[model samples]
Target: MGRRRTVHKKLPAHMHRKGNSYYFVQMVDGRRSWVPLGNDLAIARLKWAELTNIGDAEVEDITFAVAVARYRRDALPAKAAKTQEEYDRALDRLLAVFGKMPLDLIIPQYVRKYLDERKAKVAGNREKAVLSTVFNHAREWGYTKAANPCAGVKGNTETGRLRYIEDQELLAVLDHACRPLRDAMEIAYYTGQRPSDVLKLKRTDIREGTLFFRQKKTGTALRFAIDGPLFDVLLRITTDPIQIPAGAVRSLYLIQNEEGQQLGYRALNYRFNKACKAAGIPDFQFRDIRGKAGTDTEDVTGLGHAQRLLGHKNRKMTEHYIKERLGYRVAPTPKLLIKQKKRA
Candidate 1:
């Protein structure tokens, strides 16, 4: 697509004509800095006027920290709760570097310095992304007119770092995992659901043979047939007399603590990590089980079914799992059934 400059036929409210050209009498540095609106009043009135309308008074004192706070209160809530938390954490790291700087003063050079000093590239990249959003919001709010500093910055590659949980790793984790942790992992792997989602699964979500709920992150209503591992495990948990504790009420959740409370991520991680150590397994995350579910049965059920299983909005996410975690499967070399003749 070709870029087209927009033009507004009429001049804006603050703009006035000086000699042959239009100019804006707006505040800058606590005074009116006569900004040249340009000879073509139409284009200047459309493109520049919309993204930035900050007066000099607003620009004089607006700092990066102030912009971040506004973004936190106003723009952050639209994201998922988990995503909001992650972005907030990344924003804190950015604030540490440029909290005192004015919004317009934070240029690409300063951002590049921050990226270079940071050892963890993925986290740094996320911080850059969050800062970019903050600046964009600031522009819309008429706080600053600077371009997004994160526009051209590239994040470090995290390829080949993620690996799927092998069957042995599963056995090890299960052997040492508490009942709640074990149930969480099992459900996550079997259903190809996020561990976060699995941790919140309630017993009431099951009806007949189908489990249904709206996923927290995506808000997509999910319905999965409860069969195979999911069915067998849930049946045992509900029907087995020994599995139920004496005098304890059956929990409302499928994967809750002994007190029927939803399991916290920190507590689950600690227990899962301890179990992994006990089983002499390497550092494989429980979340990696999601990737295993995508590839393990996909050869038979196909990618579409696997995509649905993972609750991915698209197949691209599922494909990333198959390639990043599983890598490509090596096909068998062809062989001749009969003896080959001597080369001609």
Candidate 2:
């Protein structure tokens, strides 16, 4: 028979090494339990000891599950709804792959593998970038001390394709569109504002025949005077005693239906695409009109000015729009010098 083991009266609230691995042996009075360190035994023991010494620290292991919960509650902001939603989705992806591993077990290599697996499924540079951001935030919050798993990870190098409508197609579509959609399309063209922003225009945003509003996406305040054609279009669409519901009465969207409710972006996109088909406009997209309008107005407002009015955060975005709208191609302009006939 094996000899009876002796129980210590008091247990040490620290981790210690056992043979080749580390173990966290905890004892509260006479009760005792131990957990093994899978791979990072040394580092795990040090972390466990440090946390225990910091009085009032919870004894439970800090798992990825706990860290994610903290990220959702303490890190994300209320105003950034879209960002929060994306973070939640990314964290869910991480959890599915890691399965509630200890927080410290999430090394850069593990993150890299997770990203690689996700890239195979989603196949977008943006998704990879978002994943990188999430892991970076995790590091910033002290959930991990390892290098970012997404750091130095290269993504597919393809740029997005630009789709635009020809002038004739645009004209045809405009001629066939219903009043609300027609005004919406025309305003998107003239103002170069995104569909979401255009749909939120209020009658009050126009003052002395000029349009002014703070862009929601980029937070840029814009002011621009409208031309006669655009002014006429606005006058045609204006409504008296705006009919929005009492709950949304204070909202300042200039474009509203008979009920005074602003048109939803998806609905507007669907209707606009339908309008294009009805008008027999081939290869036309709603966003193309904005680019076309900006190109046509380039002389009046420089490319930079148009880009700012469009609420583009960077010049490269403006350049892409300009290139697509104007069908611009860059080539070296050769410089030729001829000895002017001194005789002349």
Candidate 3:
């Protein structure tokens, strides 16, 4: 007679029950394993169906490794490269923390605990945002039915402590900086453009005494009319040509050092901060100089004009720059403010 069949023989490829509530599925290869399906019976059933349809004649024998390979091949390519990178990183972190916990056993509370632990180690709202996005993607791809644990997690609020140099501080810092850093800082301060845009600036971008280029971050075309002081600075740095790898150098915004290499934004930032410290100007961030410059331009050109120069998506952001730098007060006009009637 044939040997009596055991329960383990029926569900052979590492199946486990969780609290009499759900099923967990894993595929193991000796010691290594993966939880390919977790949480709900419906989702587990669907994944099983998918596995069988894919020619896994014995769905009961499907391994976690196979499920992981299939999921990555089918689901990962659908996401953007940057997004995929973030998801991969998050998964790495998850695996480090949970290390092959059965998928069905990963309750919402387990995820919440993981997040709380990570929150202490990861320093920034960005990490939290990335985690939230990954969990959302996992749910959308049918990896889990549980709502994203990160949904209600609060992100750290960025406190805006404007580290803007006043006119006198700017003058002092610039006077002490080396020529390359000074020029770069001046352009950032004068134009209110991002460091990336300022670094990529070229001579050809300047036409009719105005610097014109589409901002790299926002793709908004900005035009800043060059004036006497800015022109003087440009004239001081205009010298020896830089050989381009592909095409001819088109712009003169990035002045090379004596070594003839372009000044990277990182180097520029470090040198700029050093100059600020030497000048005894505390809290003078590179970006604050841009705000100061924008505030100055708002008087020359209207706030709307300054808004475009700074490449702000809207006037509201531009207004914040103006208010912080110029101390421009916004109170309701007498015409709009309600006044008390004369006392009887």
Candidate 4:
């Protein structure tokens, strides 16, 4: 009287074979959904058994996949949208390799092997960090008794981005940029804010002759007075507002397209890249504008000034950010006093 299984006849109840992968059909939020149990039949069988008996089992019967699923349900939503996207990607790789493996069976050697074998070294480092968090959660959930395997593993070495945009290069890029792109570029440079932060700016953020910013990544709140060149740019944007389409809500964002919609990350990036190419500037990114602001501020005043301007918590970070983009500047040694002493 029930649906008959003609395929994967050896598979247990509720297990369905599709393509090279196996899925377990279960009720999720009152709807039947297919949860991937991986391609290996042995591993899929183990996962299915664990999933079915999860409510009546001890920690020893739990799999890493169960822990990952619980984490996704309980913790993943708390992260920022961009952060959630990143974690989702990292978790996919981790789940593929460790999903059906028992939590206690994961060890330092296995963690290191995964890191070593991953092609994207930097991305592997990020995924390993996510894995470490998962392990921590697994311990709390009583899914694992073993310590986190990723604790002792070292990530691959990473080099900081050091490209600094010169004044002429910025001007050249500006010449090739469209109105919206030019506005975005000037705001990024003058405000010395991240590209995302710049695009998030709303007209309401300007209050009492100050532009307020609350950095999403660091939770750093900063306010810059509306004066000098910054005032000029803001005035230009206000006087030449983008034309809004009929029946569409006007965008509140400082940088918006002709349709009066907020400029998306992809659109801004594409325009920026095209402008850079037209300017004949290679290896230049929009983020480099913030670095130029730091370097220029340090040059005009001091490192402390740059640090404050960039909202860095410490001088070391600010120093590293600015570095010697245009190479080091050295003062000539003062005239020696020994010659006058010898003449005397």
The candidate that achieves the highest TM-score relative to the unseen native structure: 4
The list of candidate 2 runs beyond 4 A from truth reads: 1-64, 82-91, 98-123, 239-252, 280-283, 299-301, 313-317, 324-326, 329-344
Write the number of the candidate with greater TM-score, choosing between 3 and 4.
Answer: 4
List, residue by residue over 1-344, the lDDT tens digit for candidate 2: 42333442111234455666656667667886667654453345334544454323242465555554444444554435556556555656565666467655666566556555654544435555655665566667665665665667666556554665667788888888765677788888878777777987887888886888787778899887777777776766674434556665534566655565677777787778888789877567777776777666664667788677677888888777777646664577677566566674
> Looking at candidate 2, what is the lDDT of residue 56?
30
Q: What is the lDDT of residue 88 in candidate 2?
A: 56
What's every prediction's RMSD, in angstroms? 14.8, 13.5, 13.0, 7.5
Q: Scored by Cα lDDT, where does model 4 land?
A: 0.85
Off by over 4 Å in 3: 1-122, 139-142, 207-209, 239-253, 330-344
The residue-by-residue lDDT of candidate 4 on 132-204, one tens digit each, is 9989988887777799999888887787777887799999999999888999999988888899999999999
lDDT of each: 0.75, 0.64, 0.62, 0.85
lDDT of 4 at 301: 89
lDDT by residue (300-320, candidate 1, tens digit) is 688788888877889888777
How do all the candidates rank in terms of lDDT, highest first?
A: 4, 1, 2, 3
- Among residues 3 or more apart in sequence or in different chains, the pairs in candidate 4 whose N, CA or C atoms overlap within 3 Å are none
Per-model TM against the reference: 0.75, 0.66, 0.60, 0.81
As a TM-score, model 2 comes out at 0.66
Which candidate has the top score in lDDT?
4
Question: After TM-score superposition, what is the CA distance of residue 269 in candidate 4 from its true location, in Å?
Answer: 0.9
